[model samples]
Target: MTDGLYPQLADAFPALASEIAELLRADGEPLAEAVADLPYYGPCTCTATCINLLTAPHGSSGSSMIQLERDGMDVI
Candidate 1:
C-alpha cells in the first residue's frame, strides 16, 4: 500500500506476489516503518553513489542502541 510496487508486482506475477510481499514486509513490519528512523546521507546526484545511511551503526540492533554505543566513545 505504501507504494505501487506491490500492486504492479501482483499484476505481473500473481503467483509470486505473496512471496514478494513477504520480502518487502521486513519480518511482518512495513518496509517503510522499518527504515524510517535511520539517518540519510547526500543524494550525490553527480556520481553513481547516491544517498545512503551509514549502515554500520544501524543494523538489526536499531539506531538508538547504536547511538548509545557511540556516546560511550571517548576521544583524547
Candidate 2:
C-alpha cells in the first residue's frame, strides 16, 4: 500500500483506492500497477461523475465537486 502512487487517495480512502486498483487489474495486472504508480493530482472541478483523480491542477471556479459520499451524500 506504500508504493507511493495515489498516496493521498490511499491515505484518505484505503478501500476506495484498493477497489480502483482491482478495477484496473481487470485490464491487466501490469496496467493496474502502472496506473497505481502514477501521481494522483487532485480533485476535479466539474460536476461530472468520476473517481475524482486528476493529472494536473485546475483551480476551482466555484463549481461543485464531490469526493466520497456517505448515506447518499458527499462526505469528503
Candidate that scores best on lDDT? 2
TM-score for candidate 2, residues paired by index: 0.43
RMSD list, candidates in order:
13.1, 8.9
Q: Whole-model Cα lDDT per candidate?
A: 0.35, 0.53
Off by over 4 Å in 2: 1-7, 35-38, 47-51, 59-76
TM, every model: 0.25, 0.43
lDDT by residue (18-70, candidate 1, tens digit) is 44344445335464243432233213344466433232233334434211112
Q: What are the per-model numbers of colliding residue pairs? A: 0, 0
Q: Which prediction has the highest TM-score against the true structure?
A: 2
* Residue 53 lDDT, candidate 2, scale 0-100: 57
TM-score of 1: 0.25
